[model samples]
Target chain A: MRRREALLHIGSWMVTGAAALSAGRARAARAAPLDQPSVRATIDNLFPDLPIDTSDAVAIEGPEITDDGAHVPVRLRLGTQRDTPHRIALVASANPHPLVATLDLGERFSGPLALRIKLARSQSVILLAATGQRLYAATTFLKIVASGCNPGQDETPPTDLGTIRFRHDPPREGMADARLLIRHPMRVEQRDASDIVSRPANHITMINVDIDGNPLLGMACGQSVAADPYLAFRLRTPQAGETLEIGWRDTQGRGGDARFPLGI
Target chain B: MSLDRRDALKAGAALALSSLLPACATPLRTPPTGRVVVVGAGWGGATTARYLRRWAPSVEVTVVEPARAFVSCPQSNLVLSGGRNLASLTLDYGRWAADNGIRLVRDTVRDIDPERRRVQLAGGGQLEYDRLVLSPGVDFDYAAVPGLEGEAAQARVPHAWKAGPQTAALRARLEAMPDGGVFVMTIPAAPYRCPPGPYERASLVATYLARHKPRAKLIVLDANPDIISKKGLFRAAWRELYPTLIEYRPSNAVLQVDTDRLTVRSEFEDLRADVLNVIPPQRAGDIARRAGALGEGERWARVNFIDYRAERVDGIHVIGDATLSTPAPKSGHVANQQGKVLAAALADHFAGRDPYRDPVLSNTCYSFVSNDEAFNVAAVYRVAEGGKGLRLADGSSGVSQARSSEEAALARAWATNIWSDMLG
Candidate 1:
């Protein structure tokens, strides 16, 4: 009878420990709330009057250890069980340029996303995903060893300048993943070979994504981006047999575009 | 791995034993007779000449070739990247020809008249032959890609597929590229000479750039979806040794070339190049095709494994890169083995006996991942019936498990042995 009583006591202590662990995790997730003044301000500037869940309903997936900072693969998944996910935004909290990307998905888009983003330093990347009724934010820590964004100066004018290439990965549901690499020196500064004076950014400044005449996302970046300007992202899957075109224009108005078929 | 000297001797013995007579044949044990004329004088032709001299001394042998001496394509990649010299690859045939009593004609065979049993030469000459052996190597299929048709264009955008002046020219171009420049080399579809040649060139060039021109990048654009040969070893070298210096893009077959702009346009992208080496698609050498040995509309000549005779043709045998020998790659080693096997068969044929009922062939391809490190893929083949050429013999083929300095030394020794077997 005494042994039975001891067994009951052990079971109760185990349940209590699990409860405390859950509460501790919940507090950590909520400690850096989206409602923080700076985060709230940025949020209000882009999207206003949105209540945040401050729960573990969003997860950031990526490598825990990275050797190259220029090309790190990152992805975000909605943790909520229900279906309707409208949009999501990612912030590289440590990057010189913090606004990584803002993805706008409709009812047609699905599947986990895969993308290559720049991380200036070792830090946590935060994500805020929006569903029908609530907002979710999650953070994942990453360690960077080799810096990528700025390998060298005057890396422009590659041996064969002005070459453009595109590749598309296998897509699932209504979401497609793609990559585009342009052989431009991405002359960010007023380097001599580029022949541009101060503040004349030859680096690609704007990238526009479209599918079958429908506009999707437009990105604006600065000189901190890497050379060769490799860009990869996920977007709404184009209509079957439709054409998906990714076009980019530099600050100097030198622009080009590449297109791929959606169906095959 | 290659067959050691002892294994080669064993194979020679088996080939000799195979000279026994077949059913429905007369029994006559004597040296071979009549005349045998071989064209091209490459690994295939040289081996055939040597073995014919040894196995059938009664037969008169003649080799008709345009080149002054034999220049090997096996180690030419090293020459391109400064790992070796062209002189090391150049070999003379004076000793071998004199010792074998084989007449060497420095003239190109233009056409073959099977009915008349004569060959027209480019130098306005003709040679009669009781049997003809053709080992003409591959010719580039230039129409597959655009902007490299004329001689001037070829000079500007060199293929360098054949080992000669073009190989040296490509090496010079690579040496002249800027310190931080990008060099792009595109690979043609498979079935080209030396399946690992392009990757070997890429690796050795990577080595050169890493030492002399730091920050330079090499981009290997492959028409196929992945590395065609010695894939694991090549990938390890790319990942560990040259993670930053090399960029491999496969399934990006070049569709057009802009020589003036120095651009390689593939199915999905346009790549700019400081130096462009365009290895184009390949087909059987032209003389074999024109002689109707490859049929009316065929890319490769079909052959019977019994004698390598072109289908539906008499007194003509096609070997080496010209024949569609499936499962076995178009390699010099395989061609050499074919030459030896055919030598024994011809000895029996002329001696009023039968050819070998079953034959086996082997090829070993060594690829240098760096100047001092290499890997190899060795395959053995069995001649199956119904004219399928040689089938890859199970359990006798595989790639090297790793790349190391040992394989590099073995590769050097292998090249020396094979060259001696053919030219010495």
Candidate 2:
């Protein structure tokens, strides 16, 4: 019954312009009030009242139809060469929690921000980006069909959680390419070997990267990040011998950090 | 994801009207008259040359290919099981260019002078063009495996990745092997031409062994972590049909090869077999290297995906299996689609107009699992907003739900249609 109300709220929110903004503002602007508190908090911080118009500036790249709904590879480029987006947010309307992730992608980092996310089902995946004052958006519909194998099929989770691996190239053209793979199941509800249902809902909540004590990138992941979440991004002006630190915390209150000594 | 007949006519009319307008200051070619020289007569090059003639008859199109007949690599695997012969797959370009008013040169291109926009032919000649298309396909990186570097070694254990002599030799070797002998085939990592090709070859070979040898075993060594394409269908087909005859080992990249011993060694173990098929890692053919298309240490040519133009060189576009098109597997279908798109882009360029901003490309590849059953994987791509690369079009890509004899018939039809599309 509550799902119906949430659907109606989302429908009204879909209507753009001053009417929808004001209507959404009156309703507390909760994109996914039914989701977890952390996810809801992140959604609230996204300024849902802001108007979003479709623009070609943003690029949301992924498979049109995916067999594995458990993990869908998505690459997001917030803005084009003419426009530099200061922040970007992803929302999948069909997910229990529409808000997937939000990243503070500063103006300097223009390369594609690639990561994997879990889709509940076929839905429209929306990318919202803010360049200067105006907010722009792009939407790509993704269809998730049942795998010919089992549904929710995923690679075996790494035995050790929070194990992070980094692969990066030396600075090129004032930017450095880096890839990160964090070991976490990003588990959804599943039946255990004991025939008992388990819903841990443990997933990476926050991702922080620092280079020599300076913040390089920050991201907040919701329940939708995929298993052993993989991320690839470009860092601006990374130098040799500099220490790069990556830290993440999951919903279970467990946290882990790793440090890499950059080399040429 | 195709332009209809009306759309093609509209584009042609636009070209005609635009050609009447005053020439833009930065036209791609001066005076709007252009010559296009396409190297190789494979799927991509032939399609490009043919479509270029149709789209813009004023632009001279010349195709320089070494082979007399275009042997298709798509359906060549059936040769192993005697389902299809090499002769049946070999398509003749009989006066295709002459009838279309294009030039067809039977020669090899040794080097590409991008600055001068000329290609040096091995038969002691040079062809100058306003634009050059290099669709030379893939060349095996035999040096990556030490023992398989020399010609004699390759002849001893044929890769048969290409569709000509090596394919025939490998088929003969399979027929000659004694009963109960093991046939070992190695699959290179992803980004190779035709992702499902090695598996299809393995399946047909298994079928041959099942019927003729009966006691023989086939081992597939895959470099990838798992089945990369048509995974479910291939696995199910293997389990249902070739249960006892085939063994698949994933993540088994070839570390070394002992051609004389009929052995291949991966990081995990070494296997000796009656037949060793070492499908080595591949890169853009040598002509692309001569054109400075591939970057240092890169295996494939980097192109400006919009028009398939080489990143480092101007007036030279590299297509086909030789290019690195991420998310778009290297295949003849993709090359043919790229050929049409590049042809249209060239037409727009010569007409002093901007190339179509949103270009769509679709690829459909069929893999025959046995003599009578097959499956397919299809994808549709559109130019990304910024035009860096192609993104899968919304809700337009997937694999066949199941394998069937119907799809096998469709596979043959696809081949017949595409062959005519490229060479007709």
Candidate 3:
């Protein structure tokens, strides 16, 4: 949908009183959807035809002021509504590439996900959750003490590339936590101090995990994802002796896979 | 002066009325009733002073420092590579002092009389304090290194550890050296000021040599048995980027330095250099010793980890590199965290509350592998069981997985935030 049409459709999808209140603020933010033209383009491209919901259903938790813009920890809590979102996207508005990551949470996963991302400067970090037909968005502001230097593009990857470490907590009250760490540089095009911009950005483009021969979760990462990217999420009813097959592929066409047994 | 309830209430009201009457011309002396005297205005002392005022608005804070401005030792190594200059690192305390209501005293402590709670100044002055905070950072043990006895000897081969004139001198020496010149630096053992500092210095110097004079060589003589902090990262950088330019020899302790020949002698090898950087083993600053804070023959001062009170002496507390050790590294970040801990403890004590039994401090030291890439070793320290001192919190610390330009940017951000936390 066009920006004007998205704004018009905002009134039709107001589900709760909280959603209506945000719809009012959405109209105010309508004066300028995003400060940067590239950022607006990114948002419009992500949701071309769907009307975005500015609702309390999506929650973003991050530091109000971050000392290190290179790695800022963030958590997103999707609402407890029975209708779980099919997809989630995170964006740092002013980054060289606004889109940080998009996760296809699969049909069964209702998440409280956590990750660390890179920010270029002080700006709004927006989280969007897509429920197939409808989209919900939340935003939080972060002030960078010192802005992150623009990252340099494809350098030689570390020698221990494709190394993966996976861990999971014991099931507690029908919920278990799992974290995955991948050894990838997540290289992106960056400008040097001498104003020299350097090659092809290389980052983990796809991540998929399967448990007990069933699809658990999948994520598509971007350059704004920090190096040695980490992803953590909760699992429901994780059973003993269950096998988890994890696979990921990078922009450079190199890939790695690992198998971790649950309840170890 | 025991009083009945009615009499005490009457006296309190009368005192309150008298205090209100004085507000017309003289502002009521309602400032916090306690006074804290802090010695040495480095990261530790300055942060303690600012935080004491922040936590307890009424408490008077006085800081005695010899230096006119603060020059950060954290990122000073970059000066050798021309990535940053001393001017950019040097900061004035005028604004920070004024805003925090911190009284700045330009003097050094000659001695401390703990019984009288008095601090004697070298400038023929004495300061009485209800509580004394000693954050006098590390003092190099020059006597340990034969032939490097006093100021005259240090002039020839600058330690450049404190990041001031000596740092500038070291940079100038590097600049003036001819091609194929050997730049050798010696690292003191573990428990020095900054664990990864020497390695970072070597890394940056090697970077400069590679860019300017590829034939020049940089030798690292580490006294420790192995690479200490960010070992894998530093080792990899030296191997990958500066394989030919840098030579790292661990377990090589310097025995002596001949300034005339610019040669350093360890037990195994004697190497001559066009420029020599000798970092001497360090102990608590002189004032810490004068205050009788350190135990017999102890290099560092022992303190009650709960509130950081000196163990051997009464009425004195030590923080930073002066304290008798913990798992926390002796870096600016730890000192700043210690300052906040001490300040909060004092605030609690004055408020008739007990200090926190298990205070936690987090430290992060970022070291540059080159001009554009860096890595960090971070830890969260909590009071160990039985409260002897601090230990690394279980699974609460780790080093960066790799070196990258992103980390270098974060390193700059870390320094900027920490410097601001201490003085801004």
Candidate 4:
């Protein structure tokens, strides 16, 4: 009779232990919300000294719902008047480091600039646009269902020097869209799903295009640039057969140059 | 004091009994015990075998490949341009074998015995296994291209499709051509390895010719009017960078080759070439036919999407370039994902647990227009319900816009990360 009583007592103890263990796990999971301030803190740390102000001049265009997060088309445009902002910088707050790209419009006019950015998880992406004096900011919440952070898909380290690809869109009269693609891993240091730390940060720091020795565009960049950075900006005076010289510099100070002649 | 002492003893006893109850209830399912024989060690085969060893530790994995080492086809274009060496691209199976406990059988598989679950090696040895994975890469359909027969073409006109010594041979031939000699390369129709590969090769070879042999030229005889993948990008690079040295002739197909006369006859005209690279149409590896693993058309192996097991045969799974997976290109990235899926299914089967339902697969292909320029197309796929086949998920997969610098950079990063994920 005593042994039977002891068995019943032990059974009750086991049930209590299991319940406590599950409760602890639930509490731990609830403690770290996905929308924690850590993401915002990361953005603040990426650009500490830049003179940034919030404005409605910058517009971030992306799919309302992305089917695949691996490659999402993200376009950032800065609105300006003769007396408005001269530069625009785009930041993806949900990304590991949050800063995707920063573009400076140096006395250029008309049209919008677009590029792709990678998101770490689905969250509100903060776009901070800075004028010559003040900075304007906007936030858009993007629902990312999938992540490209799985390193299993990405095995090779991109070469230090970026790949340069030039594509000629069927030229129409005097203007043609020149697409220059550079190969860089652009890995933002972040822990992946497998708990593996990503490689050190590598991104194209600057890109310059010269049409027959005349500077068309030059700009600085950050890690928010997606892998194999594609820079597609139009050239105003692209002739049927003029040489377009392109050069790029990476964060490591390595540089590469390629020249392609314009063809109609 | 007496009640507290009794309660402490009861708690200790309960903790020990609960730990014992799980062992008795679950009965550590003996991991499925069997040898998994994998034929071929290319991207698909290698990744499948690697993942099998990782996910299903109880299964013995053996890889049978003829080559001593593997050179990645994804990066071979850089080698032709002299950007990277063959060694940099080469990988030994030792690390994969020792670290992962995979058995590397360095021999050619002469025949596969599906009924006996055994494989006969070239040297009269046989390996018995419960499951077989055949990812034999790609085989050239020589009959597709007339007059390009054996012996002479293999000796003089190199295909350089296999990516090792043949790659070196083609590079040498290009380097040795006379200052004004023409280097003719024929691009196959669709469904070839690496759609952007031929164009990238042309771009790099042109880059070499521009610097080394100024008078030399590259003539591309393409089967299609426009090159696949990044044709627009390549055309821009070609016209802008090496306009004088490169000429593209689209909608031209090679009908015959005259080795003795050193000439190629197209449907339109007969052209003489100092060197020739006839990239013939490709199909699934030859072993799939002998093993009775091929589908109806003999082009690719038919496999069930949920588990990647052969649809026609039992106890066999085929992945990579050899398998006919809808919406997934015959890319290394896709193959690796398929490998993981197969591994997961096998692991569950061994544990006597129901495998996760409707496995999802993903892939991304990055193509370089030049050393510095790259683009990519990415997609995600899942098995259709009722076990019919695989389909691209409604909201997954896309190609980057025609020419965005940011998209191009992302494509390059995707390629690098893919390489690291696979081999690193």
Candidate 5:
């Protein structure tokens, strides 16, 4: 996804080079696939064998620009087509640590899902949906005013660090979706350790999910997680003697736990 | 103390196109005519609507606002201090709707279709316009202070930043406080609604607690490194007025909040209070940000200073506190002036003439240090190099040299004049 490679890729496909070139950097920006080298490399590394197809049916719906990079609201919409995607992933090209989120759309999962994610700087936010063997992408550029960060780690001190709330769907066909709202600034400290002014990188680092006295899963978040992070995942419907609990630890090593009792 | 500070600040600043007669620009002036959609009926949106009616009658206008009443943020702190009642700060928009010949739609703009020039309403249906003016105020960012958001959380720790039931709720909670109880309030970083606002609130609350709850103490937890606005005056007033009761803590960022225990956790310390007022960070209103007007990394809308148009969208303009109009404090006076200037700019543009690229706008903010004494600051912002937004007219802004009763009266008068201009 180097600039030269992107230009060559643009020459092979997409809108006419003349029209894109006439747009004045439009070819490099809008028309070029994989404008971001690292993001493209990551995707290629993840699914090197899978073919990625560009589709207009996939849309990254959010503001064209936002004043705050900490919590940019976006919605992932998939076309009402047969064999819809089973997984969705979002990446911010300019984010310090891309790969904002990777979610599995489990059985009974449906429609456009809403999200609020953090961005390190101004850049195109790429949304990729994987269905069958192809990856569909939709991107929109955001211009940031004052930059904020949640680098790759969080170091927020464990003090009244917000609260944790959750919403769990009633079991349908032995599967339920759980949305966890963990409150944290998800601040990203500057990579340069010698910087004087401490830009508070108070982001959440780890979340542990325990259901029915068994460990469910864990998420290792980066700077791309929004403030007061809201995350969704799927879990098996609790059976006899099952207890559901969730816990999270922020970068500052502060943590909280919550329990959802069994359904009668 | 003197208006001369403002007058002196603008000396030798290059202010281009301060006087541009539409007639002179175009001899054959086509009467301006087009539909203008305005969202939020606060001082900024309301003033734009009224002025458009006055200056450009033919331009059809419709304002979309969810709230039925206009709450004045400028004086809500007075309500906390008992200098004014909530009723005085709240004004009904009925008169504005009745007199302005503008269609007032009582609805929220859920989405904006920039290409289609249409705004989808929350309840349903769409309002199409040739131009859209967004003045939705600010929305609180509560990630930094967790477990203290939403209705249930707000019920416990009332920010009272917005003027309405929250303000009344905080007042009632304060009134119910025991004389020996501890009241704590936290201020977020800068680029918030008003520069000197948190201090004004701190000052007003200090005055109230000292008089009624004499034995009680108030803690001012400020996240910023220093007092942001009118520092000298606020510092002096705090030292002279309620030195014992008010403890000003600077650079103290509230890391977390535990509502169950009513405690605030910050770096190096933890404070428990009977009444906690946490003013969390804020960003542009949800709908305004959805319009893609605000830039990334910042929380307010970025606009062309000349016309207040959103940089991302062609015919949409954003004003008020939700805008990132730096070098210009987010005050009522600045928003109102931006509205008038934008109104004229749109009028002239519709008349087939270009709006000046680098127009000048001024802001005069008066903050009450007490019920009788106040301090004021004023400045003019001109378009920066290459018409890039605005910068303070060099040396043109200053905080008042002193606080006085006359300035306090002027502060009250300022509210009446601005209210009339928006609603009369």
Candidate 6:
């Protein structure tokens, strides 16, 4: 009788363990949606006519969990092909605006394009890649434990733009790196802590880089860029004593330009 | 070598005495030694350099600053309302360097030799150091706005974004305008320095108009549909204090500024103003890019919270306006706190001591809504893992929920405290 009772007890324990395991699996299966419907609609509306082929060729690399959502490091990689990919775009479904960044390779670049994206809340991001009329894509959901969208209580009206200076990275022969600095209170439009209705978005919209009177790169940016945006890119042919001109424009129609001599 | 009986007895006696004096022999306190070269002498760089010297006296510290004086951005907003003079806000770094034994070099940094651990000054002097600290502030992107350039900024318009002579120039322009003249201040999009700064300037300008020139209305043309920070407080204060003097129009994107005609052209309409405070969009300090600190299309440096070191490079530390520190707004308070934390970490490294773990930092920013009232926000941060950065401690950082009468008074007090902390 005692042996029979012990067997029954062991059997009950096994049954309970199996039940907990199944419960955990069920929770994992019910993964939260990464992209909201509104964000998906925006993505679709932006590219209405094109047939977006959702495939694994394009991957969005982001942390499964992010501590700060304001400036998340997002890397978009396209599949290695015999030729360069035709079009690559990045869309953050959870941001106030769906399209965070868009890049057209223009038949020249091949390596992965890395940029930072702003997240209003924790949401999944999708990377869409097009190669030779074929669209391939992948998605990664980032669980943002902290919200970067609403500075919440961290907003301080900056009193100083501070001192401006230029420094080059890897001061080597043939290769040079540079960054431009400015100071302003970069206020996003979505915060409502002051009980004011919705705040308007004020951000830098355009950046133009000219080397020796020739335009090297031009871009149109939005609030998705972090405060004190630090734009960096590689110059394939850096020659010493050449002049590098940079200019920036804000939505307010106010801008400034600086000329720095390249010390290659 | 053989020792005689007498000599052996003496040696044994000496060894016994050494064992007894264990406390005196406790590992010679060899304070760690190193060199830290800091670029830019703003709140971030200044505090970091100061703390580094205080924490590690043996470490040689040098700060490269081109500016002879440091005028704080925190309290400069009061200048628009005629509350303070530029001289009151300006600071000198001579005391910090001389008294603290930090080598203050007044020279522009041309380039950073990360490999050789040296910095090339603009004057052709190469200074070698083990660690480099960069806190150079932001730069403006002029091409974003058409018809706004160098001559336009100097003669016709003023961004006054960098507080100093330009800030004084802007105030002079506003005061010189006629009583009924229009004061136009354009707000940039997100991710600029001081989120509420533009609004504060607008409020101060409106205040000026309310008392001296009631007919001279302040028009705030913002790019976004909403104000960035303290919108409720600002709107409430404006409505109550200077209702007729201030008009805020959201989403009125200024396409360009015609300095000659004194008109700001927006996407929807064109408005004429006597004074145009066109705050332009901005980017990271140029030094970060020169040092290859930022990622592709990244306008800020990627830094590790452990030591505020650049994630891309090993021996370089990037702080202040250049780092891409999310969750923490780009404010002088945050920069100063980061400098202190980095100083402690550097000291630990030099002394062969285990670095202090999990530093807690605090930041509080006060925006004066009126001469009598101000809005305040404060937070405490801690480093978290998983490639993610700092996280705010619960119940540590928050905004004044209702803008209580007492809270406004406290805000002013906080402002005074911050200035003292940064400069004093």
- In DockQ terms, which candidate is top? 1
Q: Could you say which candidate leads in lDDT? A: 3
Say which prediction, candidate 1 or candidate 6, comes out ahead on lDDT: 1
> What's the ranking of the predictions by lDDT, best on top?
3, 2, 5, 1, 6, 4
Error of 3 at B37 (Å): 0.3
Model 4: per-residue Cα lDDT over B1-424, one tens digit each = 1233235335534532443332222211365486788898777777777666666677777889888777777767767677667887787654555555677888989988899999999978999988888888789888888777787665677888778888898889887889999888888765666667788788878877887789987888886435656556676778888888888865456767876666886633468888788888888888887788775556777777777778788888888877666446677777878877877877777677776778877666666555556555666788875455667789665654544455446554454454444443
DockQ of each: 0.09, 0.03, 0.01, 0.01, 0.03, 0.03
Would candidate 3 be rated incorrect, acceptable, medium or high by CAPRI criteria? incorrect
Per-residue lDDT of model 1, residues B113-166, tens digit only: 988889899999999888889989898888888887777878898787788788
What TM-score, to 2 decimals, does candidate 6 have? 0.64
Q: Give the C-alpha interface root-mean-square deviation per candidate.
A: 12.9, 9.2, 16.7, 11.6, 10.2, 13.0
Q: What is the docking quality class of candidate 6? A: incorrect
Residue B163 in model 6: shift from native, Å? 1.6
lDDT per residue for candidate 3 within B254-323, as digits (tens), equals: 8789887999877346799999999999999978888999867778888887788998889899999887
What's the DockQ of model 6? Answer: 0.03
lDDT of 5 by residue, B1-424 (tens): 4545434333312111221223212221354379899998887898888777666767888899888888888988988889999899888887566555778899988899999999999899799899999998888898667787667776788888888988998889889999999998888866688878889998898878988999999988886545777777898999899889888876455767887678987632579998899988888887777888866765778787888888887889998888877767778888887888888888887788888777778788888877788988888888865555667787777777889998898778667766776776
DockQ of 3: 0.01
Model 3: residues with Cα > 4 Å off, grouped in runs: A1-264, B1-28
List TM-score per model, in order: 0.62, 0.63, 0.58, 0.56, 0.60, 0.64
RMSD of each: 19.0, 13.1, 19.9, 22.2, 12.0, 18.7
Could you tell me the lDDT of residue B78 within candidate 4? 67
Winning candidate number (TM-score)? 6
* Model 5: lDDT of residue B35: 87
True contacts kept of each: 0.21, 0.00, 0.00, 0.00, 0.00, 0.00
